[model samples]
Target: MVTVQEQGDTVVFTVEGWHKLWAMRSELRIPRTHILGARRDPEASKAWGIRAPGTHIPGLLKAGTFYFDNTGDNKPTFLDVQHRENTVVIDLADEEYNRLIIEVADPDEVVALFGPAAAT
Candidate 1:
């Protein structure tokens, strides 16, 4: 699981517990301008294509960096989701990770933070 918090003009995503090792990251900070939007998209966590440096256990957990395709330009995605129901997808631009799919306690609350235009 991951925790989201807003600090000034940046949004912070802190990886919790063992997810840190799987995701190979302790935290990610993105400028507010880089955030495209966010949405509740549990299904997005399904069928993750290829994991370069991450962990995936079929119906269990998915944490780390993943690529949807082999194409070189395919930006990677960071995920830390165990239960699909609690997943929220955050889209970004001009960042290392193209997207973030994580399990949060309250998906609705998180989505609301990005506003209605954030649904993607």
Candidate 2:
């Protein structure tokens, strides 16, 4: 699981508990402009693949920075996620990560953090 925070003009997502030990990364931070959209989607996990540089145990766990592919001259994108269900799928742009998929106790509130202007 991860914790999301709005620090003034930026957004920060922090890894917690055992997930920190698995991912080896503590947090992801980016400016609000880098966020394209956010939503709750359990299907996001279906995209996980073995080629990605990360840890996984089938339907049980996922925690790491994963590389799916690249686009244009933009930095190669990444996917940082812990769990699939009850997830907050955040679409990113102009950053090293193309998308962020993380599971939290409350998916609805997490999605609401982006407000109505945010896309699903």
Candidate 3:
């Protein structure tokens, strides 16, 4: 699992426990302005992007960095996901990454931080 925290103009994602070992990533920070939006879909499936410089186990886990180009949101994406349900999907601007697929404890609270207008 990961914890989401806001520090000044940046939002930080810190992976915890063994997940860190699996993801090969411990922390990530992005500016709030680069956030496209945040959403929680309990029915959301696994990461649908190409696994590049990352880890995956079909329907099990998708941990590491990925890339998506065909969908237009093409960029280096970071994912540290364990569960398929109630996943927090944070869409990012064209900065370092285009998307973040991760699992958090509270999806609703995390999405709220992005606000409604963040998507547009």
Candidates in order, TM-scores: namely: 0.91, 0.80, 0.84
Highest-TM-score candidate = 1
RMSD of 1: 2.1
User: Please, what are the lDDT tens digits per residue for candidate 2 over residues 15-115?
Assistant: 88878867667888989887877788787665644434566766787767665433334333334455566777788777776677788778888778774
Prediction RMSDs, each to the true structure: 2.1, 3.0, 2.4
What overall lDDT goes with each candidate model? 0.86, 0.69, 0.76
Query: Model 1: per-residue lDDT, tens digit, 50-85?
Result: 888889999899999998873256899889999899
Candidate 2 CA-lDDT value: 0.69
**How far in Å is the alpha carbon of 13 misplaced in model 2?**
0.3
Candidate 2 residue 59 C-alpha distance from true site, Å: 1.5
- 1 or 2, which is superior by TM-score? 1
lDDT by residue for model 3 (45-80), tens: 353677777778887887888876544655777887
- Candidate 2, TM-score vs. the true structure? 0.80
Quote the RMSD, in angstroms, for model 3: 2.4
Model 1 off-target regions past 4 Å? 70-73, 117-120
